[model samples]
Target: MSDTEGVEAEVAGAEAYAEAVDVLGPFNGPVLLAPVTHNPNNGVTDGVWDVTAGDRAAVLKVLTRSKGTTGHWAASDDPRHWNYWRREADVHVSGLAQLWRPYGIRAPRLLACVERPDGDVALWLERVRGGPGTRWTVRQHVEHLRRLGVAQGAVGETADRPWLSRRFLREYIAGMTPGQELLDDDEAWRQPLVREHFPAGLRHDMVRLHHDRDWFLQIMESLPRAFCHLDMWPANVRSDGPGSALFDWAFAGDGALGEDLGNYLPDSVFDLFVPAARLPRYAAAAYEAYLHGLRESGWKGDEHLVRLAVCASAVKYDWLTGMMLARAGEAQVDYGGDRPVSPELRYRERGSTLAFLAGWASEARDLAPRLGFPEAPSGR
Candidate 1:
């Protein structure tokens, strides 16, 4: 059989079905498997399927290191790489995902972690039926951020794990080959969304931000560190009853105390889940709530320091505007789907987010000196 046919046969085999049923509980009826659409950019994921046997359900995520194609952001064999192929499996097996239950955050329960003869790992996880983050209210977003702060604060110092990602932001940013030329292309900025949302001042700020990316990375290195869910964005989170459950632990590691909040705020609007106009209000409230949670967890650090880190964390997206400009002429697709979306809508939403992040970049520069980093980096 061909490779594709072989994979299909393995996935449909009775042995795998029985294993899933064993962990998912005995079923009185036949088992069914349906493929689920997930992020396809990650090369490690062989497939993801929703497994159903009678009333029981589970998600079977097959991870393999054999994929031939490799995007710049694709999974790496290096254990400390930001997108390590086996990180999520290690996270579930080590019970790290359950450590934050007291802080009102958790990961989906692991039903089984099966190692296959073909050098793949099949992660059987409880199918959480929570509401998608796109449907979450502003209050829900704030609460989730606060909970994340509490959890990170409680961790104090992360244990030295060989597999934990190091220099994640720096390395991940370096991987992206952004279209730097588009930053100065006047015509690129003339696109409808860019013209309306990104003014000349914002454009200038974004360009400077891209140039000073290393400066912000240096500043983050000087700040207090904590265990962080480095990829805590809307699409990776879900409302689990009254609390939240985060998925995709591929980038979990040490980071600046408030770095997760920084990622969360901009990402909420990046895909238009939250309106761009409400960003300031959300940022203000979420920052305060996160601070409160940190304090409640016995953290007594300087709030200004956290604010600076949050603002400077905008450096993480320094390449995004350039990438958007390069793609501005192309037809847009909905996030994680093949469905076509209006280019105008896509650019308008994402451009507004870029403008907002540019403001944060400026704030980071201003805040840096006050935090005692008086010598600005070469780009500034």
Candidate 2:
């Protein structure tokens, strides 16, 4: 009836076609179609296969171009745009998959890649051996964070200058700005909370915090560079029994040792906004665990620095929510959520989070003194 309906019908038919034939390769006859299911995790398009050929009953995956609304920046076949989602999928399925194998990192094994007649690319991958609903407990999350730290450090040990650098931050800051109109309505309710509590200045120095070129360089040079999973959140990762494995290598690149760990902490814990009830205690435990893991992994950098970075990371997202709200009037697909976070709520939560960081930073100031680690000497 419509474009959306047409796409959905095509997808449904494709699912049927995928199921009809044996999709697993090393086949007898011409391998045609395979049974495939749509992955629920990604708003983007992905194809999952349940293979019946092998005795072990393996799974396969094919990442495809998503047939989404034509506004947002996403992976597409368009040559005019910079991002080629299908091609990037191929690089990840091919390059990073092999690079991390020796380090005991768990991820799907790349099987093969194919190009369809329509000039689209598909990546065939070994199904990560797990099911849905593998909810992560705090301890499990800690363990996963440690593994991510390990991955970062391991990559850092050999490689140099991983991808999450000052350049990346500056680009992120510039690119993240959305239309000002999106922030006009509901933000009136929320913007005050942020402005009242947190530091909201647009000075060169503040934006510089988003991309401390020197800081990024120092962190990269100071730490061992290993295979860093740029997006190391829960959805992109899974646990198979006792071991944890990460998927989604689309953002994998070289970077600092603790960068991955720092990224993982805030992201995994605060999916949207941290509930006020769970802030202090949860943050304390998570911070302690991170510090302990870092020390064990031979990290010599100040844990406080990592903490600062993580705190700053939260603010960046808060800014992002504001930017997205500024675009709400448009008919674009709202990936943030459908419930509609008013600008007031966004500002309040962000302000509270910033207040929390300032409080933590204050404690950090006194912490060194209490521990008798060192003190700022009075020169004047």
lDDT for each residue of candidate 1 in 105-199, tens digit (9 for 90 to 100)? 99889989999888888898877788777678999999998888788778755786887888888998887766777888999888776787565
TM-score of each: 0.92, 0.60
Predicted candidate 2, C-alpha RMSD: 8.1
Q: Taking the tens digit of each residue's C-alpha lDDT, what string does model 2 give over 1-380?
A: 00011122122245323432434534332223244323233423454444443332344455556545243444445422233355336445446555544434566665556665554455555656554212566566666665554444444443332222222332333444554333344453244343453345322222333333333333333333444565666556666566565665654554444556555544443443244445566666766665665666566665555554444343334244445334334443212342345544444454444445445333433453443334322211
Decoy 2 TM-score against native: 0.60
Name the regions of candidate 2 deviating beyond 4 angstroms: 1-72, 76-95, 98-104, 129-134, 157-166, 179-226, 269-276, 298-315, 324-380
Index of the highest-lDDT prediction: 1
* Overall lDDT per candidate, in order of appearance: 0.80, 0.45
Give the RMSD in angstroms, all C-alphas superposed, for model 1. Answer: 4.4
Stretches of candidate 1 above 4 Å error? Answer: 1-15, 377-380
